[model samples]
Target: MRTIDECRAEVFRRSEEKIKARRRARVRAAALCVPLCLCAVIMSVAFMLPKGPRTEEDMMQEDGEAPGGASGTEFSNDLVGDGRDDDVNAPGGEGSLSVSFSLTWGTYGISSYDSATGRLVKATDATRPEDYVTTYRLTDEETELISELIRGLDIDRYPDVYDPQAGKLGSDPSMTLILSVRMGAKEKTVTAKNIALTYESEDPDGQLFLDVCREIVEILTGTEAWQSLPEYEFFYE
Candidate 1:
């Protein structure tokens, strides 16, 4: 009961359906491949870009503030401290021996001491005058000890002493020492840099400079002076 024409038409209909299904599958594959290709291209472009130097603005933004808030000049000053200011002396000719010091980096303070009256005065910032300067009278024994130590350190002999690492970019300087001596009509001053003998050197005598400076600091501001003003560390700039 099958006719040839009817069977032929049925075959044609099935072939059309097969062709449509293949077209649909191809469309789906193309859609999927397009996004994947685009994503790969984007990733490649990102990798190809070069990295540049970090700017001050970028650093400030990362720190969550504008410049000068903390990580800028203001913060540097805080770390350095406030101490170096003009001398607060009794009179021009009163000071017989005076010693002062400052650091290129780290804790900042500048102080001047007079051996004549055992008077020690310090200031942290030059711009702002000190509200209340810390003062202490060096004991007679301490004064004699300082004089002996100074001579032992040979500070006078080396008026412009410099460490081997001086002037280098990363040279570590302990502190800049300024010593002035007024004896009769003669007045002499010595400035020494990188005074700390932190590293071992062939010359054993190299340590005398640092030792003398440390002794001076300790004797000048002993426990009594620090106990009186707990904020002594912050006194330096």
Candidate 2:
């Protein structure tokens, strides 16, 4: 019964109401989506960020060098103790023995023994000897054996340097051996180049030097501490 104008007006009103409902639906959807989008963005940014400092075990697991060209494990001088033990200087005292051995070539290694505390420190891959080091304790019997071997070397009589004669054939040495020993007030250091070649040539001094080096190497390598260390990555030819 309505007039045409009323019919038209009613239809227009319905259209407006539908449009408004659609706009309200869109607004509600946007409100919900905004928080979800923000949360997603925050999570993505957090994942992209760098992690914190690595732990020692993590560093070691990677087998990578630590900062300052050191091993993952920190080295402490306290592990070896201070050399202030009075017995170290006393003649015939329990602590009057100290010995150090080193081998250098493409690779480097060193082992030091101190009687004062029966402490033995060994380092390998000694590109930086102070970086990676391990400590062990020596039994009294082992200590006495080392002391006996060093004394038997008559190391004082050995020349400070042993270089092959210039004309000596087959003397191309590829490595160097250094031994330092201190007993009470007496100390001696011997440096032998091409020690292996000399030892093979049946030189008395070289033979003796290699013998002592082998003995020390045997002792150091036989310990559990040495076994626990990472294997040598490089070697001398």
The best candidate in terms of TM-score? 2
Model 1, 1-237: lDDT tens digits are: 679998999899999998897566444434543453354445445544447888888777768755445543221111111111123222432321233222121123255555654444544444443632455655546544554454344333444545523433223434455555443333455555553434223433343444455556656666375345434444322
Report the number of clashing residue pairs per model.
12, 0
lDDT: which candidate is best? 2
Return the number of clashes found in candidate 2: 0
Residue pairs in clash, model 2: none
- Candidate 1 lDDT for residue 35: 55
Scored by lDDT, model 1 comes in at 0.45
lDDT of each: 0.45, 0.50
- Give the C-alpha miss distance for residue 24 in model 2, angstroms: 99
lDDT of 2 by residue, 4-118 (tens): 9999999999999988975664454345434543544455456545498788887685576644444433321221112233423335457334443233221122444444444
Per-prediction TM-score to the true structure, in the order listed: 0.42, 0.46
Ten consecutive residues with minimal summed lDDT in candidate 1? 76-85
